[model samples]
Target: MGSRRHTWVRRLGAAWLAAAAVVGTAASSAAASAPTPTKSTAGPTPAELKRVDAHAEKQRERLRLPGMALAVVKDDEVVHRRTWGKDGDGKPITRQTPFLVGSLSKPITSTAVMRLAEAGSLRLDAPVRRYLPWFRPSGPSADRITLRNLLNQTSGLSERDGIAHADRFDNAPGGVERTARGLAGARTGAPPGERHEYSNANYMLLGAVVEKVTGQPFGDYLRKSVLRPFGMDGTLVDERDAERRELAPGHRYFFGHPKRFDPPYDASGVPYGYVGADIDDLSRFAVAHLGHGDAAARAVVSPAGLRELHKGTVPAGTSHRYGLGWRDDSFEGERVVWHGGATPGYHGTVVLAPERGLAVVVQDNAYSPQRDELLNATALGAMRILLGGRPAAASTDPMLDAMLTTVTVTAAVLALALLWSLFRIFRPSRGRPRGRRRIVVGAAVSVTGLLVLAVTAVYVLPRQVTVDLSEILLFVPDTGWLLVAIGVLATALAVTRGGLAVRACLAAPPLARTDPDAVRDRRQEARAGV
Candidate 1:
């Protein structure tokens, strides 16, 4: 079944590529008639890159981030790029590593759909039910949900009736069918196209449609049509299962102790599967969009689709003016086209400045508090210098970065010291060993660590960092830190409890020493020595 499904996706993907080529040809002719942008190789300078690095680091620190990978593009070329911090386990991260780009898949999917449209195989404004007669939104809303709405996120429908659940049921056997059934029977919060609401269900359903229309699975289609053409060879999709190729682990903080990065798939369990790409591959994607497939000159999106994708399909400010697959808006008076992606343990944001011929992509294994603000600020500052704008003030949040450095180093030192002390104290004493003394010391350290972690996670850290709903703490917020603290405390307590249990057994009295049975008993006693 999987093989058959993949075959269908491949055929559709080929058809889409053929269509993209035809569209590219026509668009190129048209672009020749339009006004050209001022081009430059003098992208953001090294000093600007330095500022960006510092700012991104601060954002990482503020959010308790494990690691981040970034790519900056200017005039169809990679002007700057970097990887910062550690992997899911605080192991250092590298630019070649992959991090999940969650809903960012939507734009890629939309682009493929547009290629189909260019082929005259589909239309954006068509009723989705037309393609799949079995597909329909629940009740009266059925007639209102269009392909355009699904792309723009203004569809009056949501997955699971707006209720959240833990498992990735949408990807399970018959999950897609069940989800389609749920939507067909579901109700909407707003009238069709009345408002824009981000819904994963929208894209998952779209994935199914792409499959149905092209007779291919989403991932296979993406690889053949998008990734291959754009040179995003390092990009990965649907990491529901682990694969070792260039993947980064995801993580979340355990309550009072240090933030625990999770195993790759376990780290951040995203509902829908995602596309994971390294910084360089992502930059290539950015260049494709900026270049729009003009091999001689650089461009990614077909100019017509790119323009349409940027046009506000939903009302501006009604819900961030969602377009075909991306969002369009003015950030600090500069027209910015971008999207933000979040999956279980990972957070990412991509910003593109069409006028400046510049783009930025930021990906983190764990959520970063600063997010696009610091990255965006740094990008803008760099652009200012390049464009000869007035010098901006120092935005390198030194205090936050310094504090984070101190905390991390101190924690490592303390943990190592504690371990060393524990090994010494727990070792059988050369003479007059006291089991009770060892227990007392272990319990004291464990309890003290737990208390300190609780204070930091619950009060100190949360107070110290600025928490925002739309930022890194979107899902858990107060509860996330609380969960982390509690998990840590529980682990510490478990260790102490095990030690105490061992102590109890060792402290028991011997029944007999002379008998062979007594000797056997004595060996057990020695094995359980305090």
Candidate 2:
């Protein structure tokens, strides 16, 4: 009986082994037929790129800008480039179209400073007095000024020092120097380190320092030290060169109308604004911000110097910190460095997400009060898309729209009021509403309008914008002059009507009629203000 049981067990074990062989053969065949998986690649996803392009196009259309260019950089290369609309003259915009990337000039200017420092020609912490013996601000802390402070905009020089026009760039005696020297008695914010104050004059001053240190014109020094090394040959340092490029027309946003303006040569503004470049050339700049690798590695500045250029030195007015030439912010805890610019007819931005190895540059040929916002929106939106996030909605401040509406309505209302005042003065007074208070009110409004106009349109506004009334007209056109005209006209109307109202008030109570009830009736009418 035991032998018979052993034989049955051996037979069952053989059957199990045969079934295992069949399963293994089938598994091997399936594995051989399946395809192998490849590695995930770097750069923005296709969906993300499409979304960025759509957003750029949407903004271009919505704003009706003359032209626009966009480029994205990832892992040391531009993975995408795009252009939209046409030149102001209806020329098709190409990637080579130059945009006057205003004040975005600061980063390149600051980069040159860093290179100078790396070459032992300058020091970041040294007093401005060390390099620019001529920089004399009215502030008590003037000697406390440093090169770093100027680059980070904490030197506290006010916009009042921004040279009002580009002629300062000319060869006139003390032309640009005169503009820089104007900062000697210029006002400053808090002492250098106390707070952040954004001023173009700070950089304009640095441009002088660069000129002194390099013994070259600011543009020539920058071209040799920074642009040439970075292979940014397409970058034009001269504002005149910008005019010669396939440059697009610039437009001014006036109320709701677009008024085209001749682009000016802002020579004194070169250090802080007025540099122009194509999207392709600017992609090299975006790549340079990536640090330590790739095509931009050929630039003269050491990696350490490049890193220093990005350090947050002070609080930027926005949600970022102002570094050398870069504005520093964070995206979902990752580092974001960027700058934006708007000149007479252009708005542009360049952004870098170092951790993600991504950057974006956008430029358009249109000027508006909200131009900075338009560029910033595209930059931040591009960052979001590159970081695998849905682009945030464009941030147009409703208050700006409301203010523009108010300007239009107030202008219309002022016109009507002026007309009514004239009617009251010229029309029959025998049978009509008559009151000294009405005329007084009209006079008071006129006086108030005059005071408001003097304070705002003449004094405070020009100081705030660092441009005179004429410059304002050149940039914004029509709107400013119209406002000034209304103010002048309103003041005249008020004076004339107010005099008549006073004369009516003082006139001998309509002669009292010489009747017994005449005195009483006149007194009653005077008391009742009839």
TM-score for each prediction?
0.62, 0.81
For model 1, the superposed segments whose C-alpha errors exceed 4 Å read: 1-42, 89-91, 139-141, 159-181, 240-242, 254-258, 261-273, 292-301, 316-320, 368-530
Per residue, candidate 2 scores C-alpha lDDT tens digits across 1-530 of: 00001111222224323422342243100111111112125778888899999988877777777678899887567889988877677778887787778778888888889888988899999999887776667675978899988988788765445534332435333344556776776767678877776667788788888888877878777787778767688787765566567566667777655566665565566677767788887888777767623434445676667667776767665566777888778765567778887766677888877656688898877866544465467767878778777666665444444434444554565567668867777763665444545545765665655445434533445445455556545544544565465456546655665665676555424434544597788899999999
Cα error of candidate 1 at position 338, Å:
1.0
Native-to-model Cα distance after best TM-score fit, residue 521 in candidate 2, in Å: 14
Local distance difference test, each candidate? 0.55, 0.66
Error of 2 at 365 (Å): 0.8
How many residue pairs clash per model? 20, 2
Residue-pair clash count for candidate 2: 2
Best by lDDT: 2
Cα miss at 464, model 1 (Å)? 29
Which lDDT tens digits does candidate 1 get at residues 378-450?
A: 4344344434453245442333333333334434544554465456447734554344545556666665554
